[model samples]
Target chain A: MRLRLLCCGAALLLLAACSSTPDESLYSDGSGQLGGPPGPISPDGTIGSADLNGGQPAPGTQEDLELTVGDRVFFDYDSTVLSPVATETLDRQGAWLKQFGSIVITVEGHTDERGTREYNLALGDRRATAVKNYLVALNIAPERILTISYGEERPADPGNDETAWSNNRRAVTVVTTVN
Target chain B: MTLPRSPRARWLPALAWLAACLVLPRAAGAVVELDITEGVVEPVPIAITEFHGQTPAEQKFGRDLADVVTADLARSGLFRPLDRRAFIQSPAELIDLPRFADWRQINAEALVTGVITGGEGGTELAVEFRLWDVFAGNQMRGQRLSGTPDQWRRIAHKIADTIYARLTGEKGYFDSRIVYVAETGPTTDRVKRLAIMDQDGANHEFLTDGGDLVLTPRFHPDGNSLGFMVFRQPVPQVYKYDLLTGREARLGDFGGMTFAPRFSPDGRWLAMSQAENGNSDVYLLDLDSGRKRRLTDHPAIDTSAAFAPDGERLVFNSDRAGSPQLYTMRPDGGDVQRISFNGGNYGSPTWSPRGDLIAFTKITGGVFHIGVMKTDGSDERLLTESQLDEAPTFAPNGRVILFTRKDYRDNHIRLYTVDIAGGQVQELPTPLDASDPDWSPLRP
Candidate 1:
């Protein structure tokens, strides 16, 4: 007990010299961009101030593609089979891609958060490939289209309701580059 | 009957201490033998006093070390640490002779006390701790660890490991690491980077820059490298991240998208799911020779393959039987047998280190559950049920499972751990929302 009190006295005297910050580098690399994308989306789905043009068809722009051609196609639960609505949307997308032959497009397939992540990833890959296959069948060059699966990582709606899940289970066609 | 020896025979430090017991005077009572076979239905009450230190730096480190040790023991749910305020004996008193009556008054069955010395100037740090069986009035285990001051936390973990092993008669998992995907932002544009930390969620560091999305960070059997899927270029490919040098290298050059990479138990080969022509199949890549071997040729999806501890067989999930189910086959992909006969789908089959049960995710009627079953899939037991709970990784001891639980109501995902014997489920604290956690092998 006396030794304990003596040690406490020493600790008090050494407290001033013992002030040292924890090694921050051990917890973080300091290079990580620790948050999500900036700029909030408007109610109409346009991000930030990009909607000032009143949804006008500005040529060769992301907004223009959304205006001229639909950028997404929805899928049913656990099914990669294209619906009539999806096919019709892809038909227009195929025609748009042919008109802009220099544009390279990526089909990102997504799934609801119900399944396992890896299986959802594989399902998303199939969904995106199904869309790409339809576009290729519509006379669009196969080399112009690429496919990636976001699995359930990227969702259109963060809610857990059926409506949010249905909205999340869709294939989005994004223009990668316009040559 | 003789006690079962650990397969690895890595308990030399404890054995050496026991050897010293032969020359010391025996206590009046027999050493307390704790039978942990029933698996901690009631946590053993333990008391850990603040360690004594010669200097201020040593004093602060001693307190922090005891805190970590207490947290580690408490996290396992096998030991409940008594509050420091209830302590009757001080550290100095405990060092010479713990007042057994005082400890028994607090109902502490076990007690831990330690001292830290040196580490003043250029001298190395020395930490010595003793585990006492309070009721037995005997020292159960004692050991001294010497390392640099920066490794104080690791020494504390070693102390925890020693105490846990002595009581449970099984290896402890305190001295381990976890690699998981750190998640941020909204659901749509979530930024994920491969991050690693101590098993207790300290000393975290992100391995990736978050420029590209990373998923399913799996540790190699050697524990020096990681295998994960990265969305680079237009396709998702498997990449290897070396923990020692922080070098990233793509695993294979395939015409298809590859994901869900897992290392073989021997760390010689990598198994992953590759998708071509809209169909995904399991493939193995030989790491040394860079040769590819197709493991499954079914039309349905075959992925999330894990090797048995012996490295002779594999357990994977396949949809070939109409819906996804767990299947086991030879390492060469022959003699396939479906093991999951339940109505729901079973995915993400991770073979336990004990080589007895396979842990998996079962989705039935839209609710996800983490479960384990026999190797032949006979005795199935679901351990947890939630709106979304998947990706179960076993502790090195194979007694506890760490998994991700998603609260759909709040869309918040966090890591949770539960003992296989089904007690209280504990949520592991992390700096950010995390998922796809893979526990590393026991530290060397």
Candidate 2:
């Protein structure tokens, strides 16, 4: 018991230290024109938030795709139907994949903590399939894409509130090919 | 008769019962019918005396046996084991003659007395106990179990099971084992390994090394094997674990993500869910023929299949009707009937070994609950409410349920067992975090 408490304390310290650093999901548009993730509220309106990231992410990289065209689409609770915004994100993703034709991708489906493991696994699979189908309709080769469901296992946001859950219920397009 | 000679044998005493000298004078009205529906059951006050012994080691074993047996019966929630500090009649005095007056004076309705005799060190230990109904002034049960001293705890469980059976008229679940996924690390990158322990949370051993993530372990009816899911390179697949050999092999080539594996009650078939192209369906793998048959072809999640004790019907979880709910079908997947109709989403349905109840996880109002209902879907009773409680497995006797609870307090997932009536919940101990519990049948 003492050891477990000590480990928990150590983990808390690690979490405290890690939270200060920006995670990969903190996307910043190179021009900083968009108000979505990391920007639009520059303190003096002189420096674009992209300056915080030093420079634009390299083209054809995961960061580049995440910044240039979005790499994730969110889902509603217990749903696989793609919202219009999700489709817009997938369409951009499809065009990016066409640009980088040789790069293979894996679509990872995820869910919130509200469901059981087995059912959420299936639900996440369906969500991934939904994104994959949308991209396939745009003529992306099915052979270049793989889908895996993480269920609620890997949450993008660890918080349990509705806002956290909305972010967690998502399909993430990951660059699986070696550069 | 030859006894199983392996020192690691799980139940030498249970086997010893085959040749045990039995004497149970079941007096009229002695069997107490447990009011399982009540939230607070008036526990039967029972006094247990340390077994009498001649040698110093024997005396210690006697004391340890009493402690173990008392714990087992007390955890059942049907008996209130009297504090040993309050016993007026000493161990020697009780063994000489259990004075019913002394027992009744302490408000004890039942008295248990025993004596231990054994060889030294590596030999056998023979223990015997008698249950006396202090109210009726008659003996309720008497039995003897002999085993190696290493098997002392098993012997104690056997004695407790026998006493519980005599008093409650239902089979006892004490002398059983549980296989579950022992968990560690953060929820984002959890490490889960297959683990086993006594039902009372002793003698814990991890079967797998945690290199692969394991989930939902279900023991075969023979208690020698388990079927569970493992996440390997390509996808998650159902795998069978041989308890005796510590060997594991994939159950089938489902060609997709397969999980939620459960052994049919008869151990001849393994049912699991296989998802292909986002459509998850239930399939049965015949153990004898090495063939797989699809039970449900719906484009919804249909999984968590468990067979009734008689092996005629299977109760499973499904979302084909839009939301997750409990459903029952024949073993051949015909006669599908929807069983859960409440507003909440229900999943992880497991049929009781007694063929009377189906236990499941109900998600209502954002809180997960473990609940039970009759096989016909009536008389639903929720047993627990927590931030996250899923995948309930009934005890061997079907009187108790074991499930996993994600403790928001500690950010830990642990195993817990509650009575079917929803009282006396216990956090079963493990060396590490745990989840996805599966109780094994009584050792043969």
Candidate 3:
């Protein structure tokens, strides 16, 4: 047990060191053209102002997003139809994919442990494909997408309850890199 | 009666007189207690001397019969065949005037000697086997079986079964076949088909094509038909695949998901769990009339139902009590009682063929284990602990189980058998990745 704690602590330290890098700066050229500084303000100039925090805007930096698990998608029992809320969440994910334009994402599908082995495998595939097709319809490249189904093998929540089942029947989006 | 001895005869006569005195029913019977906790896993010492023939046809059958017996005993994992190169005496010498000292020196605890005779239609095998207790210096059991040359392998298997039962006090797993699902391809597009192989994992043939996904193939009471779930169309339903006629008829549709089907001991009813809407429940279908009976009515999921050998009750998995624990109920869904409360979750409850206990998969501390408990859920003992273990199926003799063990991320599953007391774990070799193993009922 102590070894587990030590390993977790070391992992947290590594994440902290990795996340401390400074961001890059993006300034306005007073004409909506991104350049060094502002030119003389015209009469019809509408400068909404730059980000006041003065934090660095790192080049090629996509949105630092952590895809939360359960809130993304929900599946009916043994069926892989995407719920309405799931479609809305995937729309936001599709926007992320469009705005970033660089990162490739992997969508992993899982299921609850209440069905046959082969059925669950097919169900997991359908769930992942539902999400992948949504992303493709949102103008995301089908070439940048890769999917894998774990069936009921890997559970996001290990409890054998409705809460766990709802969380386990999900499709996860994992950001790999900046293109 | 004592044999007439020419030279050294005094002590032999006296010993015979003493044996008569003990058999006269005058003395009291003695009670003995022995602690036999330890025994060697070494193969039983056996010597199969080649049989000889007096006629030409006799010569042809005798040699072949002896070879069959040798192969049978060697493949049983319970006996060792003394190499023919180490034979000190010829077959004729040993059959007529047997020298016990020569066999003892070669570490043979038992020796099988035989001869062949001509019959009207086929060659008759006059086979005799003598099981000697080399350590105790006495003969244990001896018998002779007469069969034709065409029935030679049956005679050999019978000998192996007798020898194995005598030594281990348990029925042998030979003369059996294993039916399992063969898997290939990636997890998404996995091609799963029902396949059957010999008990030693040989002569594997596909029972169904991989065009459709098959899951959890179980043997019927007669061992010729398999109860499984197949997704041929968009619907997932249960069906029985007959080995003789190559016919597969749907086991009646339950509207939603229906899977994890198994046959009762009498082959009259099948217990399966079907999902309606989002809720899953257990149901029993009469094989003859296709009449369906609802067994469990709960909002929570219940599945993996197995019938006790007696067919009056069943053990199944349920999440009604908040987690997936085992529960037993009557065939009519009465007398429902919770049987497991030890830990994280349990699924796949398979009643032992002996009708005493049920084996299941227990998940605790993030590791899956194969565990067994009595009918009332007492005396829970975990047999094997691994990263992921599931699908515990018992051998027909109720002495061992064949379950899949998966480690690392490779998913190379191998079948393993362990004693009922969780000892003597041996891995059954298979050519490919196998899972959902079902041992056939004992051969008729």
Q: Which candidate wins on TM-score?
A: 2
lDDT of 2 at B162: 86
What's model 2's lDDT at B137? 77
The reply for model 1, stretches above 4 Å from the true place, is A1-65, A95-104, A177-179, B1-31
Clashes of 1: 1
Candidate 1 residue-wise lDDT, B330-416, digit = tens: 989999999999899888899999899999999999889999999999989899999999999999888899999988777788999
- Model 2 has how many clashing residue pairs? 0
- Give the per-residue lDDT of model 2 (tens digit) for A1-179: 99877755654544444335444333422222222432222356333334433234556888777766877888888999988777877878888999999988989999998888888888888899888888889999998888988888788766657877887888889998944
TM-score of 3: 0.64
Top DockQ model: 1
lDDT of 3 by residue, B261-354 (tens): 9898999999987765445688999999999899999876677889999998999887688667899999999998999988777878899888
Model 3 interface root-mean-square deviation: 8.2
- Encode model 1's per-residue lDDT on A1-179: one tens digit a residue: 99877755554443322233333322211212111222223566422234333323345655545545567787887779898767867887887887788998889999998889998888898899999999999999988888888889899887888878888888888889888
DockQ of 3: 0.03
- lDDT of model 3, residue B420: 63
- Would you list the clashing residue pairs of candidate 3? A23-A56, A24-A56, A24-A57, A24-A58, A25-A57, A102-A179
For each candidate, what TM-score against the reference? 0.84, 0.88, 0.64
Q: Identify the CAPRI category of the predicted complex in candidate 3.
A: incorrect
